[model samples]
Target: MIEDILSINQRPKMDEVEGVLFCLLNMLFYNDQKKTVETEQISIALGKDFVISFQEDAHRDVFDLLRSRLNMSNSKIRQRTADYLLYSMLDLIVDNYFIVMERLGEQIEMVEEEVIRRSNTKSLARINQLRKELIVLKRNLAPVRDLISGIIRSESDLLDDRTTKYFKDVYDHIMQAYDLGENYRDIVTGMQDLYINNVNLKLNEVMKVMAIVTCLLAPATVIGGIFGMNFEVIPYAHHKWGFYFAVGCMLIIPIWMLWVFRRRGWF
Candidate 1:
C-alpha cells in the first residue's frame, strides 16, 4: 500500500463552508450524561485507485468493516473499480447514520417520559439539548446531500460514470437523515412545551394551596386583632374560657375549609 500526506499549509484550507455536503460528515450519537444527540465528523478523500479516510481520533473509525472486506480476495469490492469502493465507504457511513438515529429515537422517548413524570429543570435542559442536536444534524447533513448532488452533476473525472449512480443512492440516504432530524426536532420541541405546561400547573397548585391557607387563617388574625383593642367592650372579652373559645374558633375555621377543599377535590 502507498500513501500521500500533505502538511496543513500545503493542503487547501476552507475559511467558510455553509452546508457543503461533501466537506462534512454528520452522525447522531447519544450522550450518556445528558442523553442527548451529538455529531461526529469523518473525512474521505478519493485518489488514484484508492481512498484515504481521515478521522479525528486514532482509536475508532467507521471503516473497520470495509477494511476487513478489502482483505477478502473474493469480495466484490476487490473486483470492482476504485469508485465502487468509495460507494461502499459512503454506504457504510449512511448505515451508521440510521443506527445512531435509532438510538437517538430511544433517547427522545425516554426524555419524553421523564418530562411527564418530573418536568424539572434537568429534563428541560435535556430536551433543549436534543433540539440543539437535531439542528446540528440538519446543518451538517443537508449540505452533504447538496454536495453529493453537485458531484453527480459536475461529472468530475475522478468518479467513474458507473460509480456516479451509486452516489444518487447516497444522496437519497442523506435526504432521509435530513428529514429524520427535522421530525425529531419537532418531537423534542413538543416535549419542551409539555414540560413547561406541567411545571406551570405545579406552580399554580402550590399557589392555590398557599392562598387557601391564608384565607382560612384570616379569621384568626381578625379575632386576635379585635381582642388586642384597647376598647372596654369586646365579645368574649369577659368570659373565663374566652381564651379557649378563641383558640377553638381558629382551629374550627381551618378544619372546615379543609373539609370543603377535600369535598371539591381541590387538593
Candidate 2:
C-alpha cells in the first residue's frame, strides 16, 4: 500500500483488503498569486480503530481547517468513528476542488478580455495553457468521483452506517465540480476560435489598404508608358506642356480615384 501511494503514476482509486479500507485520492489546489494549479496525492487507510493519512507534499495541504476543528474538545470529529474521520478528510479535499474551479473561471474571464481587446501571440499561448490545465483537471476529477461512489457503495465493516450520508454529500460536490469543468472547457474553446477570427480580420484590413494603393498607382504607370514609347506619333509628345501634362495626370488620377472611393464608401 505504501508503494502504491508513493508511485507517481498512481491514479485515484479504492480497495478493501482483509477488513482494511484503502483510498488513493488526488488533491488539487489553486495558487492565486502565481495563477497556477498544484496537484498532490493523498492516501488514506481506515482500520477498525484508527485512520491514517499520507500526503505526497508535507509543505502544503488543504487540511489545516480540518486540523483546527480536530483540536477543539467539543469537535464532532472527536466524537465520531474512524469512518467519519475519513469522510471529513475527503470532504475537505472535495471542497478545495471548488476553489480550483473558481480560480480557473477567473483566468478564463481575463483571457476572454485579452482575446477581445488585443489577440496576440501571448494571448494564444495563454489560451493553450488554460486548455491543457483544464484537461488535467477533468482527467483527475472523473476518477475521484468514481472512487467516492465506490466507497459509498462498499459493504466494508470498517465504514460506519451513520457516516454514509456525509460521503453522499461529498459525492454531490464532486458531481458539481465535474459539470463546471465541462462548461469551462467549452468556454476556452470558444475563446480560441474568437482569437483566430480576430487575427484573420486584421489581415483582411491590411490587404484592403494595399489593394487601394495599387489601384491608385495604375493610372500613373499607364501614362508614363505611353509617352515614353518609341512611336513618333504619340499624342502630346511634342507639346511644350507635355511634361507638365504627364505629371498632372499622375497627381489628378489618384485624387479622382480617392474621391470615387470615398463616394462609394470603399475605404
Candidate 3:
C-alpha cells in the first residue's frame, strides 16, 4: 500500500498536481531520479498541518504498519495529526534496529560458547569472522545512534515529549548493543591469546623431551665413536669376547644414564 504524506507547504501547482496524483495512483513512475532510489536520501519533515516524506526510492516505503493502522475503522492514527504518523514510522524503523541487534546477540552467544569449548584453528577462524561481522554491524549502528539522538534533540514539532522519550529509549538500546559487540570482540581476542599460549606450551614440552633423549644418548655415541677407531691400543680390542664386551657397554651406559636422570628428576 502507498502512503501519501502531503506537505504543509504550498499546494502543488495545478499542472504539477495532476502529475503528482498520477504517480501516487499508479504507484510506479519512470523517471531518471528513480534509478538512484536505493542510494537516495530519506527524510521526513513535519509542518503545522502535514507531514512530508522524501524518498529516493519510489518503490520502497516504510509505512506498512501505518497503512494497516490507517485502514482500521477505529484506528487512533485516523484521529491523530501528521506529526504522529511521522513519529510512528520513525519508531518502527528504530524498532527494527533492535530486532536486528537481538538476532546478532544470539549469534554472538553461540560463537562465545564455541570459543570456550574448543580453541582450535577452526574456532579461531570463526571468531575472526564474528569480529568482522561485529565491526560491520557497529559501523551501521553508530550512525543510526547519532541520527536518533539528533531527532530526540531536534526542535521538530512532529515529535511530542512522549515521542522524544521513546527515541531516547531506542538510543539506550543502541548503546547497549554497541557495548555487547565490543565485549564480544574483547572475548574473542582473549581466546586467540589463549590458543597461542597453549600451542607454545605444547611445543616447549616436545622440545624438552627431545633434549632429554639427546642427553641420554650422548655417552653411548661417545663409546661407539672410540671403539669404531682403527687404533690398536684401544682397551679390550684384542680380546676374543670384544664384541660381547662392546654390546655390554652399550647396554650398561644407557642404564646408568637413565639412573642418573631419574636421581636428578630430569624425567
The best candidate in terms of TM-score: 2
Residue 138 displacement in candidate 3 (angstroms): 1.3
For candidate 2, what is the lDDT?
0.91
Alpha carbon lDDT of residue 66, candidate 2? Answer: 88
Number of the predicted model whose lDDT against the real structure is largest:
2
Residue-wise lDDT of candidate 1 within 31-102, one digit each (tens)? 667655555555566655766566556565567898899999999999988768868877877777777778
Give per-model TM-scores. 0.77, 0.93, 0.63
Model 2's TM-score against the true structure = 0.93
Which portions of model 3 miss their true places by more than 4 Å? 1-120, 237-267
Pairs with backbone N, CA or C atoms under 3 Å apart (clashes), candidate 1: 19-143, 21-143, 21-144
- Report model 3's TM-score to 2 decimal places: 0.63
Query: Per-residue CA lDDT of candidate 2, range 179-228, in tens?
Result: 99999999999999999999999999999999999999999999988898
Q: Candidate 2 — which pairs collide?
A: none
Off by over 4 Å in 2: 32-34
- Candidate 3 residue pairs that clash: none
In model 1, state the lDDT of residue 238.
90
Cα error, residue 70 of model 1, in Å, equals 1.6
Ranking the candidates on TM-score from highest down gives 2, 1, 3
Model 3, 107-159: lDDT tens per residue? 55776676656657877776676566556555555665666666666665445
